[model samples]
Target: SAGRPMTAINSSYYAATAYRSDRMPNQPPSAERSWIRRFAKFRLPWGLTQEVALDDFLIRRKPSSLRFQEEMNKEREEKQKLGTYIPAPYEHVNFHDRHDHESFRFSLWSKRSHFWIYLTGGGRGLFYIAFVVSMMTYFLMLFALDDPWLTTTVELLPILATWIFLPLFCWALGALVIRYLPHLWVKPSRGPIWEINRRTGLVTLFDYDNNGEYKKNGTIGELTAPFYEFDAYIATIPDRQGLVTNVLYIAHRYRDIVINFRPLFAPGEGQLCCALWDFLQNYMDTSRPLPDLPRYEQYRHLDPTTAEYDRKTRRNPRFWIDMNDATFEQELYAMRGKIDQIDTFQRPNLMARHVEYVD
Candidate 1:
């Protein structure tokens, strides 16, 4: 069912939550754990899909909901005064979710239009299951033809060809649909840079070239627009049988941004995706008005982590403020300094594969 149509879970989940910071302050840690449970009870957010439910939860928890809204207000005001959407060259958004004194294990970033969402967990299970089903279907087709197993090369040729070409066509069609359905449809695929510019009232995307320059500096293959256009949607990329593997980002243009939210369809993926959306929607207040920079400025507070992170990275304060192509390269070089190695994390508890050949 991955190849099925993009089930509309929320026609405007991201858009609707943009300015609703008032409700975000009082939520406790336990509230996040039970959000899915609560949603199931109410069937809320409308257009519920299994994928959306999982992702929305994770995304919502990544940034301190309190801090995220606070920063959103700051950036919104800054954009209004400048009349441009350029990011604060020095502003760094860092979060360290730590316990037992291990310090921050994750380095998820989102400041103004910049974001580094952790979308690397879950989805392989569904894909492996889908692969198994494809194999099962192939065998069934062969058996229905009254064909013996590997009995003759001549007869086997047609069966093998059919098995191969059929899935190939399905995969191709799925890719085509995901790639070309532009202007308020799915984005082309996922890359590095993402931005929702309140200043210009547009969402911009940049290709992830290895330049290591400031996140994005007028790069090639740019995708930008107010994606609330007709035909803009959130759809999935499918395997041969059209089961969802990734949710392609769709807006006014086919931004090549496909999120692999269904690698095995683990519940964890949905969480990460949801968290990403939460960070993104902060910048995507479509009805946001200009001005009020002073109001946002007042909310800015001195963060304790700033000094510690600076020392950890061993960089100067002004170094970040004067970000450019060359400085980005230098910072990457500095990060290569050796650190203690962590234990290898095992993943993939199960797999799907064809029968192994015997000697």
Candidate 2:
């Protein structure tokens, strides 16, 4: 009875159970049958000769059914022997969740410490330069005077005064400016340098918007802008070993403070500049084990006598300043020249990369 087709049954149970009461409603055709009819127009050849009932098709009485059962049993036995079915290939462990917190803490400490060191170095450099120039000027004055007593007196007084008083005055002034000038302290016009975390990669410039506060022109009846805001990235970079390398400096000119003077060196500019100065101090201290990946390494092994590698190998990695416009080109050039002279002893390469005028 289990193997018999229900189409031949006469009982009410059979009628009630029919797929469609009017036309075998309770029993629908299998997907295989539907697929065969749908693509029958293609005239594809069939491997089996006869249409078989579902019950008989799955039983071992039929040759195809017996073969299918044997294959299935073999597969079952193999899987059982293997303990459990496992798909090919294994998953990799995600290390981010495990080490993220530690990495973040270390990065934060490094950035803070580095920034402090950088500021100290910059401040010392500034003081040293001022001292050197003052001393040089004093000597020149002595030579020009051609009077032994006056020259000696003038030289000694300024040297003693500078050594004892000038540094204190400058330090006090710097502290006062940093504290009282909150607006100027964080302002973008100060050539604000920013350092993003070491893991984030390069910081990119975003939109710049100008604040409405402006100075007015008397005759032209025009309003002068007072502040500019830039939306920029705070990003970090990684080293070859997947470790945080250094923070990146990103400049975004979101807004401009248009004043009577050239917008470039206006008062608001101090904020940006100071911010940059602050950031540079931090960056120099934090960024370490400078990326020394050999440039043009691919061509190094091509020939024993390749001139490109030979030249590059002898030269050290260089750092260059990139400027936006020609307006600041002269200032940046002078700074680069000064840096070159200072770094002459170390022989570290320094240069500038200037961008073209945009508007």
Candidate 3:
């Protein structure tokens, strides 16, 4: 079993400390937010501060010879044939591509912002292109059929609605895609930057690709939370059997917007999540308990791999939109505030005594 066990400490996570720990605990928790106390006693109880600044990172690794890789590949093939390869839910190291061995930075905001995972202009293009192609294919097939199964497939003036309005539909979809894109996208190597302002506990996201310079409008996302909200949503990863595996998702969240791109966007399993979680563990309340990982269950709540997670989002270019529109924004905030705080959060810390790389 080559699975990377969940370690108590990951040094790689702590290697990029933006501020000293001694100075951080002493700073006034959230000084910039004093303007709100004047109006009412509505304070977000999640002790936030402004002492720390998330700046940069380092990914350390050791290379292996080509012969070693060949040997490993052969071993992997044999395991596959024998059905004994049990893959770890997430592996931070990309052994095949060497991508796991790189460093990147977090993007920040001009004001209160929370964690952000950006889809670049190029990434957006790929998204729209794939979406448009799939949609076009489906619609074309529908028209060719003698009749569609769905009741909404009515012919409301076929020449005007179906033929003429088809272009309009495509235009609208394309516009939506463009709206979600940053002006440019950074190379995957540089990655997107994420900042959690100590002052407000809010997360700010910066794109190193299109907005690396941190222009006035460089920020792609800003989300706020009141106190603490807790829940376990299912993250789906495909399996060899063609079905998907359901795992408990633990990452940054604010109401409907959840940011855990570790399994998808980050190189390897997601080193940043490990690092960020480790950092937060020091500041966050520990009396509360975190959600348990699953034993055996199918995911039923949200599916991040779909188009609806984007299209159905409130604003076209908005960051961290809800998985579903049924929940009201205010209700979400209230629900989060009412729920007990939990830090299912985990980050790699080298000092954790495990001799493991802090994520």
Candidate 4:
């Protein structure tokens, strides 16, 4: 009797709220005028930006309650497990090891392997071009005859022959090189080898024991390195002295340089490390003069320690902490407030006040 009465009371309360004063207005499907006015006022320094209506932007079109509950459940589970709650498709921060002694040696070999691969590719390409030119020359001579039908027939034969035979020949040549060239060029070195991917920015390193056997403990894979989209195809072979010394310097300077030294020479692994290392070194070298600062007047009052000063140093108005400073955490939190203010000013459309309509 008690359960039945409680259920009836709850149902009545739900029915009352279902058509309550909080219900949205049933207006005609038309563009929002206020949004148009805001859009007209919103002029990007570059030019007039695209218009986004308020109804379309602010309307809660999707069912959010269930999704929010699921997200909360996921976060609770992650927290209970003592794991940081990362959104789907998260990337783990890569940590480099500073303790390894043979890291530089492996890096050098990896760079050498990349150079060899590049040289081989260039040779093959030149050979193919020469073959093509030769075919074109022969066809030109053959087609020099006065008979139009015979010339056409000869041209067709050359084209067909090239399309079929050249590819097969090249494949055979490549197979031969792959099978025999490693033995010839890759000498029995007594250290770890590293490699880089030319297409993907994947890096690998492998270490060998005293007997020249690849040690299981030494094998490492998928070392993350800074690789730009364009660096995918090009391979750089570092000069023996310059590359080895620089790698050693980096390893010594940076306490955390997590890299697998064993798989460095494997295809597609070594070159990426070389490219990334070069880029970072160039980027971080304070010896290089800073570029001309924009909006320098806005940041003149704040000291270098202040977030406002740092924002002025860069055009993007984002604050970055100097890693070398002892009060990094304090500086970071101070910058966070400044960053929030900048974000609010830059993205005004995102900060909309929730409005409830009453009948």
- Against the true structure, candidate 3 reaches a TM-score of 0.24
Assess candidate 1 and give its lDDT: 0.32
- Full-model lDDT for every candidate: 0.32, 0.30, 0.31, 0.32
- Give candidate 4's error at residue 88 in angstroms: 11
Worst 10 residues of 1 by lDDT: 348-357
- Winner on lDDT (3 vs 4): 4
Runs of candidate 4 exceeding 4 Å displacement: 1-135, 143-160, 163-165, 168-309, 312-314, 318-359
lDDT by residue (180-246, candidate 4, tens digit) is 6654334323343443332122233443442433454544433233212111112233454545211
Per-residue lDDT of model 3, residues 103-218, tens digit only: 12243231211111222233445555655665675577567776753532444334334443444455554455445532222112322444433223233344333434434555
**Model 3 lDDT-worst window of ten:** 291-300
How many residue pairs clash per model? Answer: 32, 39, 33, 25
After TM-score superposition, the amount by which residue 224's alpha carbon in candidate 4 deviates from its true location, in angstroms, is: 17
Model 2: what TM-score?
A: 0.20
Model 3: lDDT of residue 10: 24
lDDT of candidate 2 over 1-359, digit per residue (tens): 00112122232321121121112112122112133322312111111111111121112133333345558667877987998855332123221111110011111123433344445455556677777776776677677776896757765776656664555555555555555643333222211112222222222221122232222322212222111111112223344667643221222222221111111222221223223222222221111111111222222232222223345456332211122235234444544343333311222111101111121
**Please, what is the TM-score per model?**
0.24, 0.20, 0.24, 0.23
> Best candidate, lDDT-wise?
1
